[model samples]
Target: MLWRAGLTAALVCAIGLLPWLAHTDPALTVLKARSAERTPAPETLRAIRDQLGLGDGPLHLLAQWLGGLLHGDAGRSWVSDTEVLPAVAQALGASLLLMAGAVVVAVLTATAVCARTLRLGARRRLGARGPGGTGSAVLAALPEFLVASVLASVIGVQLEWLPALGWYGPQWMILPALALGLPAGAVLGRMLDDLLPAAFAEPWALAAAARGVPPKSVARQALRRCVPGLLPNLGLFVVGLTGGSVAVEQIFDIPGLGRLTLRASLAQDLPVLQSGTLALVALAALVALLARLGVRRLIGPALRDGALHSLHRPTPPAPRVVSLVYLLLLAAVIAFGLPRDPLALDTTARLQTPSAAHPFGTDALGRDVLARIAHGALTTLGTALAVSAAALLTGVLLGLLPRLSGPLVDTVNAVPPMLAALLVTGIAGSGPWTPALAVAVVAWSPLATHTASLLRQERATLHLTATRALGAGPWYLLRHELLPAVLPPVVRHALLRLPGIALSLAALGFLGLGAQPPSPEWGLLLAENQPYVERAPWAVLAPAAALALLGALAVTAAGGARLPRRRRTPTPPPAKPGPAQPPATPGQPHPARPVALTTPTDTA
Candidate 1:
């Protein structure tokens, strides 16, 4: 516990030191902004540093800042020359409120949807158009902006049910909450639907039922058992909400930490950026610690047993086919939308609102937004595909290896993928390929950990032991046994990561660490036109809509709508165990029952 606390403190300190590593001097930047000058002189920089109790050495300044942080002093904002701690405190209050509402909405909605899906499945009545299957698919595919747009159009523009923008009252948070929560809920609901049957079939659950526990109580017990599997994904969902809310907060004009970070990043406000990043790092650390504790508490027995499996349900072919068809249709749209000159500049016609001649209108530089979006779609798709493939390959190879250590695996899994990607990009420098490479590297940790866990579980099976005793080589066993069992789940896991990769890609682009100027990537378009939102809202809205569509399609491709296939247990070897085997029992727990978040269940 002491070591863990010390490591966390070290991590926090490392994050706080990021500003000092920047090419631009934080003190110089502050002096220039404060003086309202294009460039501050060396003497001015030195004087400002002296006034602020800063020094030339980065480590010295970092140590000073850390000391002040212990005393609750977060210093002053570089851009506004105002107190940083107070500003961050105010922003954090709004963000925490937003996060709480979003989390509540996510949990309740997921619970209801999961219950409905499980009930419908138990009845064996879900169809092509059923709410459980089809609705989950659709909702999972739609990105927050697309969902927000549809809601804004219907609930705001058409019915005037709520304000489309701004943070006025508690009521104003509902829309943003829904925007963040709905996707999370959709993902969580699908996970529950797939895992609940197996949970219900666990020995403990069945025993509880046979002992006169009420059906509702039994079901509640089953849910608690299933929750440990959901814990890591739940952590990811929370972090994704906090990170992805940057776009939503901007669209709705919310003054949360997300919005604050966005403004700071764009304006290069070093002090604000430093404080905001520290807050985010702290949030990530807190959530991670909570998730670990939750998992340990809920699944102590299962963890000790080292059990894991994938969901079991009949895999439907229809959704897979439908998703492919949608991808093809999207490709056609991209082909049709490709412009003769996406980069052609026309200053006279700059910042035009949407019109028939210019479907997505023009940007501040007069580049065709429609063309840019189309081209950017291709880039986004290509990058996501590449990253996903790389991540899968790396994860599968690492997972299949026999000698990986548990402590190393745990350390890897502890780092959040987004944070890792950002750090990688920071080191590798900005380029079109940087984000994809960084994301792929970050993505490997979870995938590898999941694969390794599942592989370890598979290796412990009696049949695998028999094969080993019979002198089956590693390659032969891997090829004939493990690969076949593991491939399907790995594929599904990789696909499910597509939507997240898309978001990360866009985020990198927004930060100017991805596709550069004149490239017209969705995120770059957003960064370029955000300041002109009031004058030409269409400029930002168009690319945002495209990003939403792309993310939705990726989600669909991830098998969000697909049903799970049942696992076929191999015929038992001749009984040779110490204890006599009991008669076949219903709801008997499989050795591989308790699953890791990204691990695939065995499906023969």
Candidate 2:
């Protein structure tokens, strides 16, 4: 665990070195010098001097790295030629403030939602919170900007309650934080909603509660048992707080990192661009690493138990209760659209014709306005669902197999997913698949790393030893044993991955490196309507709206994203007149593991 955390810090430090490396590279210097009509020799020399701290010596690199860590500065902006420290510093505070604000909101909101599990007679209540609720879903579906916009428009603009711009001041932070925090809170809420109940089933938690603990005490105990998964998301929610800040920043004109990002994007300022991008990447990497570290920490005790005395517990069965919600969602789509496009997207569809048949009116293309918009929903929703599920599956496979080959796992872990995504996308035609595939490939390593780590933690349990003794083959153990034990956390990890999945897809689509014309993806829609931003702002607004909707749905479904871990055990025939307490060892801890014991028929 300590080693993994150290590795995480080291990698972050390495990533911090990239911008400096790029600036100093001879070829890049030559290209830059040529562009500026200067001699590459002097520029290259100067660049080298700068990066190596040649004049500054080790102290310079040390200064920059340390400053970046403590203060976020890597020298002056290579493009802007200003103190990089100030820019980094300025961006840092805003981003952190907004992130911190969101974290507080999400934590508070989710805590309240998860707290419902502790109420009296709450067992009859489900952990599934608001996945099916339209309000949270809609609020979630609304883009951060839109949410902020509406808030500002009503509260800030008309009502004159709060300032609309700036990430500074308590007043400024209010709307942006709400905008960023609420959506994430919704997601986190959904994730823990059902999970809290499941945690209620954990042995230690129930044991604690069975001791006549208060309801709140029981809830807290159950929550602790589930920390193995929840802790990782603490890192993930930070991303949403950071990534989703762009819109809120713009709406409020906050001087935060997201605002800087907006400027960097529009100006095409490479240094600011690179630096801004680097900041985002670094933040994401840090979050991901934090998640990994948290998982490792969680497994420490489990590892100790496994190593000291194997559990040798029986394997449990996989839950057959699949979420039919997807299929039901399909039905909902159909039901929502009576003789309308089931997919709900109308790029060219017009508005407000208001006929009995064409109630929503026709689009610019004269298509069924209602049907076209409806069909459009398919493109965004289907793509999100399919791609997210795919990336998740890929990551899960990669994360769970460290025991298969330790060196291989290390090798995979060493390379960052961002780079992997860049390489694959760079090689394979930098289209939508490039990033999507990149996400699947790159994002997978962490999950794979964590999955394997968690499973390893449980390998020494008596149950595992007993299974081995029962002649259980590796395949059987994997299916029935390891999988169920870690299934809840694995599900949690997948939930955490959904946001990244959506972000990657949206990013690809946004970059014009994704779905092409006529695809109507929210990202592509942004591009298609870029020309109309001034005249028909709805074009941009609509696609942005789509992104928010799809993002919200995914995050919502992920709330109770788990399948049943334990099912009711059938009643055994009435015991004979013998003792009620049976021997602790079941079946004498079979000497030979079953060939297929990876899978089991019951939970511990």
Candidate 3:
């Protein structure tokens, strides 16, 4: 709780300092946003500065803003010159609705998937393969932005099924909700699927089945047991939805907090930006608190009784065929894209359909689509790899020191990658490195959490105790036991997260917070060609296809990295039946038996 409060305070302070840190004049930026003219008269500049209190300095202005916030005041926006609280409140309400709808959709989708798997008796089969298997991987890999673009183009524009542009009614929320929910649902379903087998394999579940309990009843019981394990991640998903919806809101033109925050940051509207950040941070903290309480209520007894030792099991590697297929597709994309010049433009062939000269069709600028995607692979994929690798290394190291990393992880994890990108852009200004930097800030938390949890389990093993008793030094134990035991799983976690990191980068690029125009980045390609969707759909499909392929490859490859499972403890021989004690009187307690306890060995 202290950490959450501190994180919220820190973020609010950081947002307040953005104008100062960026070394730009907030007044000038606001003036430019207000008018088309780049330059304004001295009188106008002075008037604007005076009105917005720019001369008060960032500290004094921030202090004044904070003072006002204590009494239900958020000040007024520099851009609109209206009460920031009301505008922020409206945006927050919309975002809350969107997030609530997305969460409901995600929960239902996951429940349906898990129910199907359990009904088909595929729990063990799917669990062995990990998560939702290949299908979920494909679904999870689809970025929200890409999904939104396709849905808006096909369902909104082509089929005329729903209004995708505005948020007038509940009907307007469906597409954006689905776009956010489906991918999150895939992820949640996979996680639940991975956990179901364990629940079903429990002794209680086995006894119920042996007693001829209905399959449906047993399945319900199993789900109940597994849900507690998923609660933390569920909270994460909700918090993530708040930050991840920025692009979706923009695509749908919803005046949600994310879109509002993005606009305010760009325009240097400190009041609006600060208030939005505070709302998001508060939402995250509340979610975290509720999730913690829920998990404790559901699973606390089992943990206290030592009935549950660990929530995670070792994930098996992907099938050879899947890995091979992913590699082949990746190689094919590279082979086709590397040879051509992405920058070579021809006005004569602009917006041409896919042909012998341009396999992926030309964009508005007549540049080779295939060539740009291939080159973009370097920028997008390369950065993702670098960020993932860095996160892996950093997470493993920090995870070894759980005490030091715990608070940091909790605080950083509260801020989603999208929110982090907004903050980074605000501080440093948007550039090629902004996406990578922003992603790196939030990417380490998951891996660190995984490693820290695994480390705790590993330390509790008898083997580790014996090794320490034998005078094995910390470094030796870390190298031979801890690192060996921890690295593979942590690396696998990082690999599984690779696609998401890449997607975040792409989303940022799509939002114009990444590489500028003519860079051929995949996200930028989608954003650049969105307006010409009807003219040439191929331009948009090409990059979207490339991103999807990359996601599939990462998921498949990560699935192929297996971990050595811990050896199970051997069940002790049944003790000779002891003579039953006489029943005690109503007020007297029964005598306790002397029970032997044994430490479990760890032989991974």
lDDT of 3 by residue, 1-604 (tens): 5755676678778878887877887778899888867677788889988988889888888899999999989998888888998898898899889988998889887877676668743223434533445666677777787788889988998899999899999999999999999888877776667556655655455555545667777677667666765665677678677755777998899998878877887888989888887777677667767866785665555444334433344556667787788779877887898999989989999999999988889999889999998888887888999999999988888888877775666567655465577778877787878889888888887677667755654554446677888999988887667776667656755776777787677767776788767787777787788788778989988887777776677766766464565576999999999998688788764555212221111111
Q: Candidate 1, residues 1-604: lDDT per residue as tens digits?
A: 4544455555545544544534556676566555664567788777777875556565665676677778988777766879988888788778878888888888987787677644543333344322334465456545565566556655776788888788889878888889888877876776555556655544454455445555666556557656665665576566556644776786777888867766665444645666776676566657766876886666554445434332333344436676676677667657767854788889999999878878789989887888887887777777888888888888788777634522333333444444445555556655768778767766765566456545644564446667778999999888766775566555666765675677677767666666667776666777677676657889877766565555546545555433344367888788776876565468765544442221112111
Using Cα atoms with residue i matched to residue i, what is each candidate's TM-score against the true structure?
0.72, 0.64, 0.84
Candidate with maximal lDDT: 3
Span of ten consecutive residues with least summed lDDT in model 3: 595-604
Q: Which stretches of candidate 1 lie over 4 Å from their true place?
A: 1-20, 35-39, 70-86, 112-116, 124-138, 141-160, 163-169, 197-222, 261-279, 305-320, 344-370, 393-426, 441-490, 524-604
lDDT of candidate 2 over 1-604, digit per residue (tens): 4444454444444334433433334334424533567556766757644653446533355455555646555555444557655685587678788788878887776765555555631342443231133234444454454556667766876788888766457778877778788867765665555345554544444444445556666655455444554555556457545643655666677666655654543332334544555566557666666766775555555555453222122223322232244435434543554465434455654443447765444434444433444455565555656765665576567557554423333433334333444345435656546656665654554455556555665575667888888899999898877776665555554654453455456555564555654553444444444444444445455445445444444444444434455566898999778666554476564333222211011112
Regions of candidate 3 where Cα sits further than 4 Å from its true position: 112-116, 120-132, 309-316, 395-419, 425-432, 448-493, 506-514, 564-604
Superposition error at 213 for model 3 (Å): 2.7
Report the CA-based lDDT of candidate 1 relative to the real structure.
Answer: 0.64
Candidate 1: count the clashes.
4
Which TM-score value belongs to model 3?
0.84
Tell me, what's the RMSD of every candidate? 7.5, 9.5, 6.4
- The best-first sequence of candidates by lDDT reads 3, 1, 2
Worst 10 residues of 1 by lDDT: 595-604
Cα distance off (Å), candidate 3, residue 601:
24
Error of 3 at 37 (Å): 2.9
